[model samples]
Target: MAKEFTSLGLRLHADAPHISYVFIKHHKPKEGEAEVPNALYVAGLPLGLDEVSLEAVFSVFGHVANVVLHPSKRSAAVVYESKEDVSQALQHASSGQVVDFPLPAPEGPVGLKAWVASHRAQRPGNAELQKQLDGWMEAHEAAEAAREAARQAAMAEDGWTVVVRSKGRKRAREVGGMSTVSGGIAPAAAAAARAAADAKQAKQAENFYRFQQRDRRRSELMDLRHKFEEGRKRLAALKAARHFRPN
Candidate 1:
């Protein structure tokens, strides 16, 4: 059977963190009904987690209905069949421990559908919006560059020294140590390393900034395309209704 969203009593608030109240109704087997109960609602969790681990942890209490992970938000939704199962799951669902990440605690009942809708509605679509996104991306890139420079400078100041392991040996085995360079690092090597570090940082920043820009553009284009399609469908429906009107 298809999953029902209405079964979860989800209350959506504009200014607060999303939350939802889930209530599962128990019913006896009529005739050849499945022994396990069906899950009514699921809560979304933060991203970067292994599905197998979550399943293993939650399954200890009751059967898991669905666990949907969102890539962008880095969150997931886990649905349980019975209220008793939910209670059990809640006991083990400690933030940043069981899942190896901090889970956002919802204030009250929340609807995932509504939250998605709100994000869609608030998304930028126009040329001005694109310009703003580009500006933000550029600013982020610049800030990242400054941070990289600072990190490299700090590393250079706190030089890496080579320490000999033994006193008598044909070739001494040098171990890495963080000690001040008496004569300072070779100017050429230090400059080259700094340049290399800067180049690497710039490349990484550019790649990340470009990726974000591409995703934003793609989302905007898709939203516009969907809206256009909906308008066309509405127009076609109106035309068909008018043509088929009884005289």
Candidate 2:
């Protein structure tokens, strides 16, 4: 295993009189320790970030292996199946890349922060970096399991949760809270949805009836014209067949 990052930097500053801000960075990699090439560490994310949105952004390059978002820590870790995918995603959004991609938000014109995952700090010639990296992998797995459990618990007994995906971001914004009685959704939103559906059906039915009426009227008109034409032809035939009679 070759060291992925050669340097590590962590600093805390008092951004405000009573608030402290922490900044983290990775600089160098050690010898023989393979870099954590498949994972990405994201920071300064917007509130209510989710795995699907992250995938929609990064999976364009390749398959996303996994995503672990630390809500408490206000950061997230994204893993990819291939190094190329990681590079592609990073190139699209990394602040340190040659062509940096700033992941802009929809509501505001602000870019999301993103970078490649780095192992824990170690001495210049120590082999302990691998141990730390292995620990990180274990922790990530545990966090992911916990997140999935929480999501399941939040849903109704039917294991179904309905969400409307916004055009801006694919985040599932719940229109209304769950329905306690039916264990589905709120009554008001459901009613609105039902009403909208009914209106659409009514409109379609009206159009269909109008079409049917038009076709029936046209058919009747054609039949009347045909009858008149046939009667005229019969009268002409009778006149021609009869002897020339004086009235």
Candidate 3:
């Protein structure tokens, strides 16, 4: 710290109870220049005061180069283009009364009255909202149509003919000398189905052969029984007619 200071006013509130002043005193002449040139430390700035307003306030004395405000501390450091403006500001600060600076009207409407008027003006009418909704729906339908066209183009590249059905879901079949549908039965599944059918036919043939053999054996047994029964009857008749001799 080179021990250099400058005077500036503290405008904390309009009727602040006490007033404080900071005076710049130089004890000894230093060989080099000051650490910060043409700068004044300002305190007691009102909250919500922007840099533009601060600059405008200080620019009356000189061209304000920059203003760094600390809202929490309610203080700001103002840098002037030349040292003469610093001297002028310091002279103004030496007066006991606060500087009378004109605060510009706020950029936009503020407070409850202005806010209510702005809100009412900005509110959208029912007709406007409905028109916006209609525009959005139209855009959405156009986008869907574009996407469908692109999808059909891509499918046509792969030799597929898509059939769109109104009642059910859309299906695509292979065309241009292609045998199968795009998403139909796979080759492995087809092979498995053929194998199952062949196995079923083989089982039916085997069962038929087994049934023929069983039927033939049953018919032979029935014929032998019939012949045996007829021979017994004939022997009985012969015994009755005395044409049988015992040996």
Model number with the top lDDT = 3
Task: Provide the TM-score for each candidate, comma-separated.
Answer: 0.21, 0.26, 0.37
- lDDT tens digits, residues 172-209, model 2? 34423543221345667778999999999987786477
Q: Please give the CA lDDT of all the candidate structures.
A: 0.54, 0.55, 0.68
Count of backbone clashes for each model?
13, 13, 0
lDDT of 3 by residue, 1-247 (tens): 4234555554433555554443432223247845666776766555446688778877878999998876573667778888788777767766644554556555666546665777878877788889999999999999999998787777777877665544333355544444333344566777899999999998778648777879878999999999999999999988898965688
lDDT, candidate 1, 15-101, per-residue tens = 434543332232224487664344322334322234654555456568876765545433344567666786554444322122222
Best by TM-score: 3
Candidate 3 TM-score, true structure as reference: 0.37
TM-score of candidate 2 on Cα atoms, chains taken together: 0.26
**Candidate 3, 162: how far from true, in Å?**
1.0
Off by over 4 Å in 1: 1-47, 92-247
lDDT of 3 at 146: 90
Considering TM-score, where higher is better, how would the candidates rank from best to worst?
A: 3, 2, 1
